[model samples]
Target chain A: MRNLVVLWMLILSMSIMAQMRDFQVITPELTGTLRLGLIRQNESLWLSDYKKIAAKKNGTETIYTIKHEWLNKGSIRISTKPLLDTHGFVMKIETTDIPASIHLFWAFGGCLGEVINLTGDENSLKPEFCKDNVFSIEGNSFTVYYGTSRKLRILEALVPPDSDVRLSDAHQQQTPLSFFNSGKKNDAPALAALTPLKNNEAVYFCFYKQNPKADYNYFMLPELYKKGSYEVHSETQWMKSTPD
Target chain B: MFKPLLIICFALFVGMYIKAATYNVKDFGAKANGKNIDSPAINAAILEAEKNGGGTIYIPAGEYLCYSIRLKSNITIYLESGATIVAAFPGAGKDEGYDAAEPNPDNPYQDFGHSHWQNSLMWAIGEKNITICGSGLIYGKGLTREESRLPGVGNKAIAFKECHNITLRDISMLRCGHFAVIATGVDNLTITNVRVDTNRDGFDIDCCRNVRITDCSINTPWDDAIVLKSSYGLRYFKDTQNVTISGCYVSGFDNGTAYTAQWETDEPQAPDHGFTVGRIKFGTESSGGFKNIAITNCIFERCRGLALEVVDGGHMEDLVISNITMRDIVNAPIFLRLGARQRSPKSTPIGAMRRININNINVYNADSQYSCIISGIPGHCIEDVSFSNINIYFKGGFTEEDGKRVVPENETVYPEPWMFGTIPASGFYVRHARKILFDNVRFHFAEKDKRPLFIFDDVEKSDISNIRVNGIKVENPFTAH
Candidate 1:
């Protein structure tokens, strides 16, 4: 019994130690460095480029951004925009934290490659792809980063409860199909009013929708943020917290 | 005996061809009286004839006063030469529920109130195939300018709503107070060969469809000489579709601000443009949209704002505006503002303006301000825009040094010298647009502008070709800062 108790404590300590990862974000030049703020589900948080990924927090809202990173660090990429095969989801984010980096990962049903965003936020990134590919995107966050592995930059582990799609992941996600892609619009105005924020009221905004019309899709971004960038203000985040 | 029989038969045939009835205002011992002739008499005559199987209600040569009158199917209200129908005075309703339908009521419109309507001296409701054609005069007693000063309400004129397949031709309407003649939610209507003179809007159309207003001369002071609107009323409405306003001459105190220059109605101080659109938004009262709208071969002279607006209402799609000629405009020669404000608290419809096409537009001698502007929401651009053989000018161009103007003589711009306000955008200004294309565009300035005429705010996937400014190819306006 004594031996078992000691063994359990040792195992617990080992798991905790593994969580203390050497999560350093480095430029390809091995020059710029940034400390990452992370809470991990796995080793998904330790990326090589901080500019390629960023976090934005607005009290209850939190956004995660990942750039359309690919190819060698500091090298131009002619790759397609990031997308998924099962349910192709993409987003773009704009930020300045990245020095130089590109993150690309592969799990494929085919080869359309990833959606690459050259610049800015709020994009419906569509890239030509062939057969099958599985991907996820930050949707509307754009930031600067530098690296060479072109490894995957997963955002789910970083985003808060309600993160908006990044520019790199523009069209929600392409599953076997996308309904709104048909474009047979609605007649009655759906709504897209932007009441200006009074200087004193509040900066953070929130919207909740359930089943959007089959023919229409909507996206909302603050005036100040860049594509693929949650660096300014986190736009939207979905939390799994209890109602209480 | 055979000849006698033939003559009797011929007489019977002639009797069959005679008009069913001939009732005149004079037949009732009615005189012009210079006062508004009660329209009930004429209406009674018309209804009587209809009951007797539909005929003509002749308005002979005389000066007559009149108020609202309705016509049914298969009826003709003919005005002979020298006849005149003077409009009833505007009803006075310091209160909200005053019906413009009845003439003599409490606080009658001698002239005052915005809540009032111009139910046309000769009006009709929800019926079909009616015609009002004549060479006589119809006097719509406009407010005497004193009417505009009334605190809340005041618009005197003739207007119609929800009547269809009607034609109004060869008449002269004078000094209308509100809208000289207004029509809404009606279809298959045509107005031709009419001359309207007024301080109010010459003709106003809203949420109406299949209308044609051609070969008319409209002169007004307030808004569009002939304006089409999609407004938010008691219901969010699409007051227009498939309308053709061609071969007409229009001019206002300023350029018409119909959907083009001004589409937002946040200001509560004024009636907005009689020529403006979307002052109200799409919602509650609405569950549909507007499609296939065209404006071609029209002339807008010295107007305030020109062009169609697919504002922030829910959705305005498939618009084709072309072959437009504008001269001496005060503000923008062409403007498209596509945004809506959900002013109502109800389950108001939202924005969805899409699939638009604007081509073959020409503008000249607009004021020193900007000439053309186009903007869309962030996700949706003013898409597939192609300007072919287009020519626009800002008349007098501003200099970059205008920002540095010495104002050697003391003008505001010259003194402070940071003239940020001197140059207003350009011939083409795209904001938050996607997939836009520009072909064969010519933006001209008075020889001295050193900068390119195209200014893009935030655009993507855009292609430009055959574009010239001051007869020179477009210089790159984008540079690394």
Candidate 2:
């Protein structure tokens, strides 16, 4: 009976940890549990202005399809599929009614630590991060964010290829949740402006619980044979074996 | 009327023939879905192109798992974007893997990988006007990084021997075993816009002439990025001459991280338990020599720095280097060694090192354990080397005892900086050298260091001027013998 109780307590702790890591919409404005916010501009439509049209499961993926009516002309449809394995999500927006711009804002409780822009630069040895919490991603396709909190969390945003998208850290003034609540309780949120998506487009955002480890053998190359399996012949031996 | 009809017929025939010159690998029964071995199909395409007096073998966008793709003369292998050639592992049987390493009678002097060229993913011997280009990837996923006599194992990614008029451009390589590209006894080589993130050496230009390497980014955490060698593997003393390397970036990042753009910095040390060894160097295998080489506008990051060595029995001369910048250097920013580790036949004498000019170098966050070393053997001295307009910043916390440490002359050993521990100088250490000049050189230390700025032992006819240490002017024109 005592061992059963210990096992139950272990299961309870695991459940609590998993729940804490789960990303969900915390506010009506679609503020994620990890402080990721979505804002649609050109009259500023939030998730609260949208209506959930459908939710379905498709092959190990739960996709939520939502729609927002803008100016009573047409409704924009957004399909968000959470990638459980990668701890990320892909949002596909399809509509003829294109907004002026869409942006993903991060309200990290004003605890943004470091931001690194990795684009065409592939020199891993000398990586340069932003200084003084100020960064510009003018010509970058990807960016990584780290929080100053003790929790080991990282956020990455990647722009889709061949898209007319620009990533920036500019401030967005749309809603109250778009502002970071520092200890002072009022600060501008870090913003990434992905402007002018076409009729159908998608973007990916990954919030990792921990830093991803680099895979040394990413292709799974085979190991070499042991040293004892072969003998290295010397010059004298090779010369003797050859016919002069 | 008959003559006009014959001319029209000939024009039509030529147009059709030109259109048939392109051989697509997919049309030749290559299942490029990363499943089946596609080397046989690729080789068949190459043979067909060669039979038609040379043509282009086009590989479209897919993953092709291959064993060995033999190269032929007058043929070009063009890979389209999103095309990847993955090296396939050898099955457990004889002749089940890549082509066997052909027997090399002149294999006594060099290592096994250098002695043979057949046992590789792609190889060419005695082929001219051959080119491999296009924005594709060569992933050595099944090649071994070790020297093994196993029947079904391959080592090198691309190995060329005795070839000429070669061009390799716009290709990216990852995790290439032993070497990403090794060109031996080849002439008129041009490599540009090639990116390689590998475990071992990136490019080994040995016994070649008229080589140009431009705009290459190579990252090798455990080995040299680009090393020029003149080994006796060809069984002849052919000097590597008239080479130029410019606009290159080399680094010692973890393998594959450069491609993925992750930039993981936790692992500061290499797997070999030495300092990360990704830098530009010349010779630990100088059997013939290097001449008329120029390197300019290069960058080094988180690795060793420029190393010019002629340890084997050869002559290294008439070299010029300019416009180099380094950051987070793990060892000496400049190492020039002329030693007597002659790994040649019985009658070969010691090599010579002279006539090297280096200018406009800047280094930051360098290790204080080793200063810039300019060393030679006891009886032989390196001659006529000059350094100008150089600046270096070191992470320093050395004591007086560390400054008084004695350096050993490992004459017959391999040439590397860490072979001698804790050099006594914090700026420069000179031994057995002559006609050396340091002009407008400056050194700065992050922490307190007790070593002198310059230490000379057996140095003759050296001129040091406009040298500063920690923003303070040192003795001007410090000359010693």
Candidate 3:
């Protein structure tokens, strides 16, 4: 009976999930780019939206950065050119500074939005940013005409930005290392014949792109006989003569 | 004379009492046409039988291409051998003043859309004790030459919305141009021994509870073979709880590399994802996520990525996967990833509390490009995952560099093409996970492969024990495929 009730509640909540709420995407920013001195000399690849309530990756939110915290709602507006590639008052921030309530403001829509061009006149920030609960941004550093003069946005957290954090070799030296690579050619015959390779349980395929230009980003797919994921089964303890 | 008449009347009364009441569509004169037919005559026959309180309405075998036929409570539509219900074209029979939907307290299905609401083959609403049995077939010939490409036209074989105690057995649903069979927002539904061959998803059970699917065969052209969806109506993630899929054979969805086209188009159209289970939508609706589904005793072949996924912001809990087998898959054997780092549900307070247990499985041959990917949010880790007693085979192997190990493709063939995408891995990889355990697991590859058997990123509280790796084949005696 209790299981039935729980299931009924689960079904009820699913209908609730289908119910919509009030939200909007208001801010945006594009951070870094593969710039070239040769052809068009593109300044940056737009990555994040400063106008959006949220930021992407490990970025800042619109609430913490505009010198004030602000909530977003539906029906937002976009300016033709924000910041300066610079001709007019392209950016204006109603809220000029980060607010006290916010923890971390996401950048771009979520990634850290880098506001580059503050031409002599044009601005992305609106004047009544804090009073009207909005912050418009404009930059002069790159070509942003290809982007939305204004686009929808989603607000996230307003976390302070930090540099990339890759782990140091503190544990690498202490931990034991294992390797399992089963590419083609190491067919079933080779796998069975290879000595000193038996009973080597647990396999992980580490996929890393040497550079950003690389297309291969190795991700996991499911297989019946491949036994791709590592697990500890509690129900079935009987061992079969399966090779790992 | 009077005494004789009384005996005759008594005998007639006894016969009427003994025989169960039955009504046939032929009694009311019904015809089955591929086009130009009314579903009401057959529906009326089913209802009259139910009004007489529970009986069977038999569909004689022939091609009856008709629009939505609403069902009633306490009824069983028995498809006598060779009965086939072909899906009628959408907007075909709406010319006259025909009213399809009217609200009724006795029927809660009225709150939901019509079965023909989107041009489905057979749809039922708010029905109870409904059983569709016998060796019949429902065909949605969406791939036909006379088909029209109209928007809002959904071609599904059978759709049951807000129904209860529904069972469909010994049936074949084929060539549903879009979705083959979908039972959404209903309860106590069981589908068994049904073979579905379709151009789209074979079977989809979304946003319901106590659903069981067993001993079924699903052959699909794209996306999941037997998919369990947690959300509906382009809304936020909805929790699809207590789903069990066992003893099923699945194949196909071998279309490769989804990044071949642009993400968005300027036209106003339904979002396209013949392959996506959950997606980020422009919020017109949202509530909770999905959780507590179990999939066991299944077989897979020629698939693309992880058959099980927690990609969208749906709530997932207690996902138990065991006794599985696989062979000749295109991509990694398992891919459990949160969407783009920024698009992860963490920032939006949408938690996908995922837990996976994969045990007693064998994977024969895996040839994947960029095999396994795990990219999830940091703080809201994909928690409580376990993989034990497993064996995997990656056909090719790798070699050790000056001090670093490198995959074979990194040096020769692939060389990391900027445009074509990257090459995948030969073994286990996890990211942003917590309470993860790996015991008695083996990853076997030859000595010529490059990649780590285990890689962790932004993970908290992980234990890897009883692990064995092959193809190390070095002098150190620590490495050996």
Question: Highest DockQ: which candidate?
Answer: 2
Question: Model 2 TM-score?
Answer: 0.66
Q: Model 2 over residues B1-481: C-alpha lDDT tens digits?
A: 9999999999999988876888999999999999999999999999999998999999999999999899999999998999999998776555468887777777667777787788899999999999999999999987866444455568899999999999999999988888999999999999999999987789999999999999999998768999999988788888999999999999988667887886544345453445578899998788999999999999999899899999878999999999999999998999999988877777889999999999999999999888789999898999999999999999978877777899999998678787788888878999999999999998889988787778889999989888888888886422210
* Order of candidate numbers by TM-score, starting with the best: 2, 1, 3
Task: For residue B175, give model 1's deviation from the true position in Å.
Answer: 2.1
For model 1, how does the per-residue alpha-carbon lDDT over A1-244 read when each residue is reduced to its tens digit?
Answer: 1110100111221112112111111111111111122111221122222344334433222244333232223221111111111111122222333232221211111121243322222111222221111211211111121111123121111121133221122122222112112121221101111111121222221111111110001122232112211221111111111100
> Where does candidate 3 stray beyond 4 Å?
A1-244, B1-23, B26-28, B32-38, B90-93, B96-118, B142-154, B232-238, B253-287, B340-348, B397-424, B446-448, B470-481
Screening candidate 2 with a backbone cut-off below 3 angstroms (N, C-alpha, C), the clashing residue pairs are none
Off by over 4 Å in 2: A1-244, B1-15, B476-481
User: Alpha-carbon interface RMSD of model 1?
Assistant: 28.2
Write one digit per residue (lDDT tens) for candidate 1, span B203-246.
Answer: 76666789888888775534347766554431434546777766
Q: What is the lDDT of residue A121 in candidate 3?
A: 28
Candidate 1 CAPRI classification by DockQ? incorrect
Better of 2 and 3 by lDDT: 2
- Best TM-score among the predictions, by candidate number: 2
lDDT of 2 by residue, A1-244 (tens): 1100100111221112111111232111112222223455533333432334344434423334444444234434433443322333434444555444544433322223333232312211111221112111212122232232122223333333333332222233244232322111112223333334455444433322111121111111111011101122231233211100
TM-score of each model's chain B: 0.75, 0.96, 0.74
